[model samples]
Target: MPSLRIACFHLNQLGDLVFSLPALLALGRGFPKAQIISVARPPHRELLLLSGLVHNVVERPRGQLISKLKMVSALRSMKLDLAVLFSTSLGTAILAWMAHPREKAGFGKRGLAYRAEKIGPPSVANNLRLVEALGCRVEKRDYVGLVKLDESVRCRVRDLLMHAGIGESTPYAVISPAASGRRAIKEWTSEGFAAVAERLADDLDLVPVLVGTEADEVVAGLSEKIVDLRGKTSIIELAALLEGAHVFVGIDSGVMHLAAAVGTPVAALFGPTDPAITGPMGEGHKIVQSDVPCLACMKTSCREPLCMQRITPDAVIESVAMCVSEEKNV
Candidate 1:
């Protein structure tokens, strides 16, 4: 549309950035000459850099109103032609309005001042599926695939694999045991992940690469056999590592979404969250959840987490085995 400059606002968590990759791809294809700019958290800047579709990344600081005002001023300088707010936050819509883009699009029940197109009811599933609902005339809608890595990051991942004693020819599965939130109800136990990893290692001969941020180190400590790569790799490097892995097994976390974005087959464990809404969007994703009445409550704390406790290690092991076998056959 005459070399339009587009700005996409997704200042949420790391997984949110990953999930929005498909929409970014669609924008790139739909407007080939458009200069795509992404405004997101600092931690996700690397991800935006790795995504070849983005022309620039505007980092939004989580701080006072003065800081946000400064960011808004910076966005104003960009002179964006179109803005897409992928997040459901009012702040994002406000930022888009502050940018003064020609056209703004977002999803919310209430109307936003600058948002020209508003998709009804902001749900997790609808948010992820917005590439289609937004009604952008594109050939494909299911573009939520893995993000590409820069050459430098690819080289770093290769070196990391070599340093870990994992040969290029060796097969491996990635296990991410930690979720982002502090809610114990949402997370499966560390012992369950350990058991799955051990079984996968023993039966399938697939080495398990444990991945997460620094906060997940304690969970990583639970597994002695796994190659503890927590807090060791950057966002781009993690994408490269996930791209090479045969499969990914993890709880409902950002890494799980990252794995799905990377186009890796995933077997995810779900507890207090609804898989139908937040599960990985892909063909090869297999979600395991228990039938507990209190499940999908999205509660932060609970004395009893039957939803997660019922998801035994044996079930995960079996799922892993099935995924491994299917991959081999492919």
Candidate 2:
């Protein structure tokens, strides 16, 4: 008999893709001999390839209709046995439908052979429901990890730190002060982050490290002690940095989830987003949010954004202290 050929239509963003890891883990467990292929966009495609979860990855087309059509032709040639859709977009649904898989699994009633309710549970647990619809036994411990990094990747990250004047034995705190899109309401004040960085240096004795894309360089020039690595590290390199951190301080964003995945204790500042729905997974996470009435409104634009403003720097400092102390105890 021919080996089973499976395809996973992956989610687009870094954190969303990380949330879907457990479901992919379920697929691997359920079909141990299957050759799994993932359809993902760049950077994430590279991240997934390094993860060792999928057998191969195909770059998802973007921008042009001609590129999408070419991808469709390529998928059609593969003659996929099963197509698992992690993205609920209409374009992804259409792509999977055009591929003509013998079995289809996805969320909602998008004409799939197996469907799971998109709502309910945290994002990670909700993703697991999709694979459970296919009779996969979801393991309790599978939801905690992100990707496996080889020794070479770690060594490269170490060299990067050495170039940045940080020694091998140095303990650092990674802080991301930016949120994606127009969600300015999700970000804490720069002054707040600066205060936290000061406390991390003076109180906790950890050097502060700023991380994000070039677009996320909002926290730069805050402190000379803070090492601004924003726009410098790739996604995998960022993971290595987070893995070595004493703790991560950030808003509700993809980097925060990445920190959690790499087993770094997260001191996450929450405002408009609900922590239960989209917060970091696993243990040793400290969530700092005000007790506002409109706490989890999910609003992208807010003139005042009282929820974020109300979160005092002292509160965040306390959380960071707790995170460090907890990690030391463990």
Candidate 3:
């Protein structure tokens, strides 16, 4: 009631965190006077701080009992009125309960122990249900673009583009071929990407730029003409680069989400993952996927990744070309 203090737990990867931005924004808007504290993984600190969705970013210690206790104790010390568990993990649910906030909300049965209502919705809209439960005004946001790029960052990105021989007016397409180690099945083949790169150059007359960490080196040889910016830019820099591009072509990776968040037309290639849920949301985004019945199996490891192999380069090229053409018309 008086000067509300809230703690929201989201100890997830970059893409999942991005998906929660809409709900976070709605929550912040509902309680302008409230201190929105975000407890997330250490890697998410930059985004959580830059997003302006939360006032504070607290790191959730990885697999440490004492550290977990300290985290929950710290929240309890703040006299939090509400604790929203954006994460579905049992650990996070227990932490929220331990914090003993006046109101607790999350999805699943474990969360129901702390709060009577179980938050329901897709990933993006899940936390909004928690905010609405507390009688907060939640607006329907079209896109949950949380990051705001600074003018200085934009200038730096421009300099990088110039260095890469990409002109100010040059229309380019950004491609990311990297995925986490465990999700290698989600990545399309290197040969497929090379074919797409050549198509972009010959058919679209647009330069192809690769974005990712040095881990992307595996796909670096996909095409020689591609400008490899892997391991060269920070996360924010990658976002800036993707923001300026006309089209983004990538797997369902965090970089893809970054590009989509910046409103770039994305031709996302979905293989082992489900496009309906994890696919890029909002307008101007197309999912090029194989018609494999087991396509969305969500398997981390596979002896034969037929789902990814089924997604041909021609299909991805067509999707990217269509997206690029649509952008030009706009």
Question: TM-score, each model?
Answer: 0.86, 0.94, 0.87
Q: Which should have the higher lDDT, number 1 or number 2?
A: 2
lDDT tens readout by residue for model 2, 146-171:
47777888898899899888899999
Off by over 4 Å in 3: 61-76, 94-100, 110-122, 141-144
Best of the candidates, lDDT? 2
99-161: candidate 3 lDDT, tens digit per residue:
888877766664342442433324565556656766667776434366667777788889998
Give each model's whole-structure lDDT.
0.76, 0.85, 0.79
Q: Which scores better on TM-score, 1 or 2?
A: 2
Which candidate order results from sorting by TM-score in descending order? Answer: 2, 3, 1
Which residue runs of candidate 1 sit more than 4 Å off their true CA positions? Answer: 64-67, 109-135, 143-146, 182-184, 297-301
Relative to the true structure, candidate 1 reaches a TM of 0.86
Error (Å) of candidate 2 at residue 252 is 1.6
Count of clashing pairs, candidate 3: 0
Steric clash pairs (candidate 1): 146-261, 146-262
- Provide backbone clash counts, one per model: 2, 0, 0
